[model samples]
Target chain A: MGARRLAEMQVEVTVFATLRKYLPDLPVGGSKYIKVDPGATPADLIQILGLPADEVKIVIRNHVITELDEIVEDGDRIAFAPAIAGG
Target chain B: MTRKIVRINMSNQKATYEDVPKKWAKWGGRGMTSAIVFEEIPPTCHPLGPNNKVVIAPGWVTGTPAAPSSGRTSFGGKSPLTGTIKESNAGGLSGQKIAKLGLAAIILEGTPAKDQWYYLVITKDGVEFKDASDLMGKGMYEIDEILWKDYPKTAVIGIGQAGEMKLSNAGISVNDPENKPGRYAGRGGLGAVLGARGIKAIVIDDAGGPGVDIANKELFEKGRKNLTEAIQEHALTKKDGGLNAYGTDVLMNIVNEAGGLPTRNFSAGQFEGAAKISGEAIAEVVEKRDGKGMTGHGCHPGCIIQCSNIYPDESGEALVSCLEYETAWALGANCGIDNLDIIARMTRECNDLGLDTIEAGNSIAIAMEGGLLEFGDAEGALKLFNEIRNKTPMGRILGQGVEATAKAFGVHRVPTVKGQSMPAYEPRAIKGIGVTYATSTMGADHTSGYTIAPEIAGVSGKLDPLTDEGKADLSLAFQASTAFIDSSGYCLFIAFPILDIQTGFEGMVDTVAGVMGIDLTGDDAIALGKEVLKMERLFNERAGFTKEDDRLPEFMRYEKLPPHDVVWSMTDEELDKVFAWVHED
Candidate 1:
């Protein structure tokens, strides 16, 4: 019975502007959202999706989400923002 | 030419509206004003006193109904940062609307009572000074919204808190269509001059505007077609999703990859976390998590190339995108903070306070080295920016300029040239930009002579990235060409296409000549550019700056930038000889 009978949880992933190149399959607007397992954090999910964490400059969560150690929960939306470089 | 130049003597507060010289019709916009500043205003004048005059002018195409032609405001002021000539342009609607009022330039002279606030209103009704005590000390955003709300259709240019104290990095702001006074003349402390004048805001109500009179309708039509088509033909325009889509933040990764991206006061050429702070990363986060538009859409009316974004907080809240590469590098890599959201917030603070992001970034980096803040501390940067508005002692030290900040903190490794903060491009890695940084009359600046013209766009055969053998000549070519482009009011990025081919040049010539009733040739363009550069140089010379002042900081020659152990190798004699064309008999 060790948590085997419960349903798997899901975490939210959000990308904007040019970062869409990482996931082109995602539609133009949000809610083209992908589902990830509940235990996996945003960093782990980015790794699972092959996005290099080093390139992600801004991370938006509900609270003081620290580094890779921070965990994700159900219905939590994590934002990924890259540095903007033009004039 | 049916244009007028408004010259105001700040010493006496007398404004003169005079007709522009026919010779100037050949170089409209930034070109026209920079030329006027060089010819009329002696460069030896004190930058802040009545002796100095700031000329704000628009480009030839500025008032035209051309899309994305809304940018093109030029300000020529004896620079508080460089102690010589400083002219910086910006993207905003005030230039377009004001120029459309048939003005070649508007010169603001002399300061007003320190405590009183006055407003300048220009329209068919004529120019007048109005009281603005209610608007004093308000943020640019707040002031702009109120003005626009009262007038509804007029253009407003206002200053923020930092400008009131006459900080060296203060920038003037213009109201945008979205009511965001985010558009700015954001360089060389021009906003401080306005603040010093007790001029809180300028409300332009040119509703019944007398637009620039095109002499020949047929020629103007033909020229407009060429200019538009040339821009439209660019692959980036069609493929990269209008800069209007994401703003200029798209350059973060690209510049980082080129090895010219500046990090941590230019100690390194690249940031390990650059990708995280890139346009791509910001776009992704804004879309998926916050369900908001990362692309800000526009700064002025009819700007098709919306290269501006509203950088959001980590929770996908609004900050400010001004998310430019230089800003990102200065605040992020230069200060060792990799967080894009925090950088956006810092940009928001600068906009609200009316400060130049580049100098602010440099100041913060210097402060961090001085132990005022720890590396990667977002709260520390915010604290400094907040104090900037308050004009605290430490805040004044930081707002004064990068050189002053470094001196106050006793930091030897400060990145500055001619008392001005160095731009995003590392002087060591980009030797061509290094030459321009050293020799530009305006002090260390990337736009002075962009080597990226050669580095990014292969005008000449692409040499090794760090080689300096032919960089001097290349730099001269860029500086000259850039001067011409700056005057045209066309975006400098258009240089990639113009330098890459002949049609682009043809389009530019047609636009300038047709607009001003002249037949300008390619050779004429060369002469004009040379003349403009000569004027800038002459101003610097009159200010007592010689070839010795035209060299980069001492550290550039010794410090080896990582990834490539490159240093600024050009000697003073070589740099002097680089602009040999200027010495032609």
Candidate 2:
């Protein structure tokens, strides 16, 4: 139930920070037009978007990071921010 | 012997610059900052109003070759977070930069033009106002990076998201050793006021050709040698694994094992996952998982302790190791989270968004009590921040701080003293800190008089960390002496080997004197501390807070902590007497 066509979901994805290195032709901070895969959980989206699921630190929805299984409705703005350790 | 303060009155957009009053120079660092704040700022004035002043000053040897003394800068203001006068200090290169500018303190007064966000930039050439519009809405790290890249060799200080939100736990950040603006004046909500006033950053550099004019080059060398040696010789200082390798996260398990750790919002004294959250654990994981050179580093330049760590997961993905003991307690144990990754992510969120870890931790714990989410449910807490990141209703309230959290949660058992969240140490279990957490001008601060007294067992020799005997006297003495150490810009760990020695602190005073070509005595150091203490006490008093405000939380004295099964027993009368001055002095 967590997998679907990318174009149907009508949501965009943005992977922040280090997640850029692992994405497909990724944006510096992340991508601007990561069309979400249909029926995909945040976990599936992260995996399909090419982020290591185990290390995908923060996921923001609508300008705020959401939980892993949180629903991604149409037109949702999902931001995947990497965890960077800084003292 | 040194320079004077430049007071910037925002009301008239005027600058009142004067020589360092003979009275102020005697007491440097926190001492001088507090003294000036009390003497000038009217206590009755609103903390966020124009009448309130923000005083930024360097320590005794802020610009000297002294090791840990390099970055200690103090900021004094009527705290929007505490509604009382607050003087918070943190490590960053800004202090040295400000000092080199030939100004001891810079006072920012009134509010700025609402549309324009202005920041202070002090180069050796002169001070000027810079445009911070592009800089606004950026996180601390982003601000630090932009400022440093744009203006090389300049140290920057800034406020983050929480500060922008005007939340109580918000703090100001300064560039750390790696030049990340992650170093914060972590306590109090002064950051909010800065953000509210439309000030985005303060950049101080040595750009105008000539830098800090050396008063006595020959004297500076000797003092530098002594300071470098002193740090190298100290046991805790010599080891990189302690702070530099793991950061303050190392203290988590140790404090828990010692039965002083605050857990589950102070309902307990030990955390179940203390080991996993410890500094040592951080080092092991960072080394093995993240691989090579990911250990803790110092917060400022030339710091030997280097106890602050930058931890990433096995995947080479970042997690926080600045995970200080208090932060670990607040976010880890107080919220019942044992997962290190969640703590790391949460810590970063707090830092990036500019929230106080302790207060946020307490706020989350109270959320657990209120059934907003389950205890230790990392996602729930993460979502809370997402709300802030999203600006949700719950997010705004939760970000507001502990008092609001408690109110929202209908929690009466708040482990706080002055509307501020308490640190990691449980006052009930470690009774001496009770005095400190209660009476500190900053409110509920353990560092004010950390009661590791019994837990630490004293570094010079062995002593009981568990016993209350002589603890009161020890707390007072530590507070007094620590004030002296903090004033000099020397790291607190200097007290480890130097506390009992007559010349231990004297060496510091002598070094500052040598560097500045001023004859500084040990007596003067202690005297400066007393003056600062008196002024802080006076600030609290005039703010309508009396001795009544100087008491521990009800639960601390009434509830018994496990393992030790003890509660705070000191009476109000006894606690009050701790501040009594000796007739001889």
Candidate 3:
């Protein structure tokens, strides 16, 4: 073969608050691992999970609030939160 | 209705009503309380001494049924904890009732000559001093039950055993709509000030009282309609929105994800147990248990946000009401405990003992760091609360707050500013909040300036949470805006929508203008905020606080917190700029 597609990468994903409705199979406050392309971004993953872009206010990768377009690597831990705040 | 000031002299036990001075007519809530404290109390005098006075006031819109979630009361006094001029606001029936009674402010002055406790019954007519010896040495819940039996259909504000013990961590408790010892003016140890005055409680009966006066009915309706619509339309505050769905603790997972959650005595940015105590978890457990527990509860009547909750036990009995985000993080993540049930129990105990949950939880975490117990020890944390209840020497030390506990244990990594413990957000990760914690007049208060909105939640706009650039400006604007919100008698949560929507901000200003019949603009309202800050700064300066006291703890400067691995990088120059206008004034 002239070129072989890069191996699919696994990333741990968790959704919190109202966004939990999209990931119905995920237990409350629990996370699951999903396979994605090597150069996939958080937005790509969100699209795969069927989450609306407008509903998500924050995208966190490896415990840091990041842009939805930020690159997600293999074995990355990602979390999504809605527009929520309290003092 | 003619709004008047009622001065209660504790020395002679007399309550006298004085007409509101022309100079003080425009003030209400924190503005009214701070103005009174600055004028009456000597800065150098002992906070618990007779020279100090306590001022209780309602906001301009408090008693109006048309104003949504505006029934907030402000309590001001010289704090025994920090020796600073303190204004603590709470939500309950007290503000609405007091305002309806036609009182602008209730000033409690002097100290009792004898070592005895008394309660005051305030009606539309006058205040009556009643013997409270029978209710002495009781918890807040017990006090609420006893007081309601004798004074039904009224609002009660009182202190519990913690205040009776004259502990610096004690907070004044106010009854919610259900008469629970939940709502509180829970910071700065104002409860100790009240305890020192020998007053156990004040029962307010608004029945037969004249209601709040609105100078311009058409203007009031216009402003009220605008604000109500904004609050209803905003995604974070509207029905079935973020706050209404999950309460404030909804920020738990998000803060943790932002690497701003202070975990295990500020040593870490994220807690492995964050999920267990997150608001999402609370909502799920409540739904699963299907018990008496429920979310979307209001702390006071006419609150459309309804972000409070009632947590229940395994038996389906209610455990605690309104388990807040700050309380959850302080007692759960900061202390390294993950169990929601244990955190709820500790919250219940704090309410009963009239303790500030933030201070109490920080103290416990400091104790853990000192090796008194292991992190994540739920039983040990509960036992420490028992010590406070028993008034043991150890208990007394812990009840004195985070700084005191740190000193007692020789722990150098204390997370406090101005002798007050920090709330949930980690300063290292969120630089703007760090500036707020360092420079806030009432000590390290998050509500003083909540920059977490732009920094983490993407409300209004997004900013780099880890950077020091332009943070001082961000914090100053928030602090100034927050001062206006606090004085208006609106809950600080209103800041969420007002920041995102311009009309929401205009609507808020218009309401006050409508109430006072004054032409006030948004800029003028912010100027009012700066004016309040100036008074507070002058008071603190007289009380011996310098730019030196406006600083984060030494350890925060050196230690690199995990995840982001950042320290308190903002310099003294940056910190000084926050209140630079105060100094100029």
Candidate 4:
């Protein structure tokens, strides 16, 4: 089946650190389900959420650090974080 | 301005000053301290004996208004904990003050034959050695209060009961801007070295003293502007950025999500209650409390990127000056406790006792693993600190750090390298940091070289956190660059911007050259770092360390951490490849 023709899927999204400002309704470190098209990537969700491309620097999928182009699967836990560094 | 190195002998209570030699002219901070320590102290000398000396030096740009966040000092000596030449630095008001006073370094040598306590009042006139009988046995909090009342606006570097007992985990405390004894040169038992010297405190007043001399004013300003622009423009370091908004604990959730947050004494990779103790949670609590709590707090003056914070309690009162990521991980998830307030209290206790929070938390976790106390027992964890404060036998064992506590309890899963406990990052999950932890001269310290930038934060370029390929080279590059940064007197957080921005790195080197009126390049700065590391490695080699000491703990080799289910898989050859130049003739 083509990705474009597939049904919508839900991915759990959590924005952390300064990225939380983009998702004001969601609590910090708290996750919310977002429905997207079948071939949705972290970049797609980010666009859907209206987060600035420059502000969201890191994207984690299923507990692994990954690029924004990686497609999200249903029930996959996705996290967006700003450029955060410390020990 | 002429810089003088102050030498104080405790045996006769005498002070002497010497001009900066040409050989040590370019050295400052870790470079200065390590060079002096390797030259003066015997490699195999007993760390607590009269032969051992403590060298404290500020970094190259410290005390200058042009250098942002350049108020850090380095303390070097033979570590009683690691039995290696150790250099531990801290951010406080002292480093800048020391620089403004026209002093390059302070060397403390010899111990009094009699058990006498003394404190030094240092100023423009000279040093005044006075009796400190009343301040003996007091906590660092009390000592800071008492000393500040006597000598207002002066920076205090002192120890607490843990240091008095010469415990292995003791750390020298440096007061923050608020006079809170929270900043620390908190590793490798340097506080015990000072305490063994019979010194209670060294109060410094830099007012009316000659400030730092910049050789080329125009060049210094140009370099400083470039570096400051990078710091202010970077996403992680800029105003209201991640660090300024959430402080260092901002890494908690991300690390937890990546399955790199060590939990239950490194038994697990992720914590169930990570959110409760995360930086976001702390910010939330700070907001809810609406009292003395705040974010964007700077550890030292002129720090534009303030990653420090004040955590508060239910009453909206200040609980701790800064609840850092390492402290939160060490005292919270590492011990199976998730309460921020409890962690803050433990943090406060560690600060008061002049103890390294990482070592203390690891000790408590090891004790818990040994059946002394159950994991997640917050109250029991709180009481264990009292054991150190009261100097009980159990307390003595705990005060010696995680490795000692592990041996005392017969716990086999010891998480230490070179007799020092590991920091927040789990090497099993993040292979690159593991390389740095194992090969670091000062044991399993995260700050020795922070690869977390590329590995976890995607600062310069994202690397697979799980891969070990080329990590040896990666760690070595970071270690060398970090050594230069440490010597430059800027906070390590500056690396976040400088690594991603080329001009910032050049600006850092230019600042050093601009200050000394000498021609220097990036290669020279890194070579300086390498030289400092080689000096430290040679000292360790003379002190009986070998390639065998560069391996991770035995348990990490086989036992896999959960979530990612990874073990320390890097080969011994790969580890040997790092710092291979140190072995070259």
- TM-score to native of every candidate shown: 0.85, 0.82, 0.98, 0.98
When sorted by lDDT, best at the front, the candidate numbers are 4, 3, 1, 2
lDDT of 4 by residue, B1-585 (tens): 778899999999999989888889889999999999999999999999889999999998999876988889999999999999999999987999999999889999989767798999889877899999999989999999999998998999999999999999999999999999999999999999999899989999998989889998778888999999999999999999999998999999999999999999999989998989999999999999999999999998899999999999899998888899999989999999988899999999999999999999999999999999899999889988999988999999999999889999999999999999999999999999999999999999999888888999998788999999989998988898888888889999999998899899788778888887889888998888899999999999999999899999999989989999888999999999997888683
Q: What TM-score would chain A of each candidate receive against the reference chain A?
A: 0.67, 0.72, 0.90, 0.88
> Second chain TM-score per prediction?
0.95, 0.93, 0.99, 0.99
> Which model is ahead, 1 or 2, in terms of DockQ?
1
DockQ of each: 0.10, 0.01, 0.78, 0.82
Task: Estimate candidate 2's alpha-carbon lDDT, on a 0 to 1 scale.
Answer: 0.69
Quote model 1's TM-score for chain B.
0.95
**Deviation of model 1 at B548, angstroms:** 0.9
State how far residue B276 of model 2 sits from its true place (Å): 1.0
**DockQ score of candidate 3?**
0.78
Residue range with the least summed lDDT across 10 consecutive positions in model 1 chain A: A58-67
Query: What residue runs in model 3 are displaced by over 4 Å at the alpha carbon?
Result: A1-4
Instruction: Name the top lDDT candidate.
Output: 4
Scanning candidate 1 chain B in windows of ten residues, the lowest lDDT window is: B235-244
Docking class of 4: high
The DockQ value obtained for model 2 is: 0.01
